[model samples]
Target: MGPKTYSWPVATFDPLILKQPRWILAIVVGVVITLAFVRLGFWQLDRLDERRVANTTSEARMSEPGRPREGVLGEHGQEVNEMLHRATSVEGAFRTADEFFSPGRVVSDRQGTLVATPLDLADGTVLIVVRGIVPPGTPGPPAAGFEPPSGSVALVGRIDDGEKPIPIGEHVPEDGHLASLSRVDLAYIDRWIEGDVLPITLILEEQTPPDPGGVPLRIPREELTEGSHLGYAIQWFSFAIIVAVGVAVLVYRAGTRAGPTEAFPDGASRL
Candidate 1:
């Protein structure tokens, strides 16, 4: 038999290969990518607005005067409006004998216990007052007994809501007398007092005697982080835009590399 011959055509770039399908895909991809970037930019703008509003609300509350002492303790709505650093005054006597200790509190890089005492207000309502911090290694109940300010003392303090309880099996003291559990369970306080207790709590700021028991009252400091959300929002949107653009560029390149010759492999040549 005669030698079999095979001829393979040399590949050549055809500018006409840029057809309707390629143009369509390019337009669709470009539009989609552009839309994605625009959406992300708007999302960041929205987050910036939200953060601004939050900051304004917080500032307004902080700048406003403290709630009136007469109806403040029993009022639930007032607690939500209270901001850190806002001061409140109360006329009350501390329940020294019935004092409780909150363990595992850290202040100024030193581990300490927060002293909580039920303040019996002049009107017979009980409000939980976090008097001050006691140094670590001090026994749960000081041997000399906890001493609050002397008779009918007036106190100015910052408002605080209750805290969540520590997990079960945590190393909270079980002894009911010397120390109670880790959490300030308000319900338990109410039951113990046998009266309607205020939902709000206080961190003592100023007292009649500046130095009560030689321990100066510690006021809480507020830490604020500004523009954090706007930064995060920008990051998320930037990532989305990068992803969309990358996909579009890859699709456009692939389409451009494919020529019209492949559109029909077996059809006869048309000049």
Candidate 2:
């Protein structure tokens, strides 16, 4: 019979083994990546905080009683951001000739176009109003069935800021009397409008003597819910943990695979 063979177990988990230069580099890289992921997680947390504050402010502003448009604007116009979502009342006559369409607005998963019109206030200034959403494919101005009521009108609406303008090439037609605009940018619209244009847009909530046809659907108030920032933060933190675990696993495998520095028979004696 062959003599029984026995060997000592290698020290696979020795902390000293990880002191090698290669392992040190791996650890440094892993730590850097982990810290980056942690930073991303914290960044998401910060975004969550900002969102909460904004939501709170909006809710508070929206719940208050409506104020006169002039009062909201003050002697010198207030920053649009500070007044956003505040309810206000205005009286003006619709300048239907200068109307434009803002396409690609989606409501409740249904696509539609927003009818943007210039309202000539009594003071001779123009206020941009997003009246409501219309069916897709509706024509721009002087459109049949979608015409806003003629003559002076009173409006109750929430204050809103304009959107970023679509680049020249991207706007539909890109020519005289634009049929549709990519967004509700008042600064861009001011170029074509005849009078001074208000910096903010009014998202129309109520119109006196409602449109007889009711063709354009009234846009609902925006729903305020905490977004997915928390989930993203968790995901980033989980990635950091996973990277740490992966680095630990790789280090353990490297140490184990390196084998022992010395091996001895079971009965052998060491000096």
Candidate 3:
């Protein structure tokens, strides 16, 4: 090869920028704002990905075979939080005497209440199980014809995060009627039972001695509604691009504009 040629690095920033010192401030501001918007767009996309993964995992877990209640739940409880919505089986007797009614739950478009009863395990640990839903037509107190099975029972249900606390005061359940609990919050469950209780709730899928007519089997339904995060991310990125394009147009205008003129001129030149 002839003398080794050295390729000089190309200048990325505008060379004419030094001539128009004021443009330095505009460019800096534009870059900062653009970066901020771009980062926000990426953050929203990350959130979208996380939400999608969570929903998909939950759906998959719900469909797969359930794990043993003791193995997953353990003694400390709420250990396998990532396994939410996973199906599981429990062997215990329903404590109908301390049955709780979660008010204002809707199923299949019709409004109703969820029957939450404690399942006293052999190891003395109490688990709150949401047995099923009572239809809107069913009257309160005794839940019409619905009653939990007597003696030992085996249940299959999907794992659930205990209900979020609703704004409601404590109300004692009557002798025959189920207690009107505003939500299935663990704090509320503690009020109904003594000592430590399981931190999760099971939405009844299959229960022995079926009462199909009395309490309809409430299967867990997945909410597949994709949120507007993707749209929001697009909007942010578009805004950043628009701002960048505006900066480019500004630089182009500066390059093409005529040279600066004198502020003051002689009388002859003024004419």
lDDT of 3: 0.74
- Candidate 2 clash pair list: none
- Give the top-scoring candidate (lDDT): 2
Off by over 4 Å in 2: 1-16, 167-175, 257-271
Q: How do the predictions measure up, each by TM-score?
A: 0.66, 0.86, 0.71
Question: How far off is residue 25 in model 2, in Å?
Answer: 1.5
Name the runs in model 3 displaced over 4 angstroms: 1-29, 74-78, 166-178, 224-226, 247-271
RMSD of each: 9.3, 4.5, 10.8
Query: Model 3 reaches what TM-score against the true structure?
Result: 0.71
lDDT by residue for model 3 (118-174), tens:
888888878888877787656643466887768888888888878787566556666
Alpha-carbon shift of residue 115 in model 1 (angstroms): 1.9
Top candidate, metric TM-score: 2
How high a TM-score does candidate 2 get?
A: 0.86
- From the highest lDDT down, the ranking of the candidates is 2, 3, 1
Q: Between the candidate structures 2 and 3, which one is better when assessed by TM-score?
A: 2
- Shift of residue 269 alpha carbon in model 1, Å: 33
Error of 1 at 216 (Å): 5.4
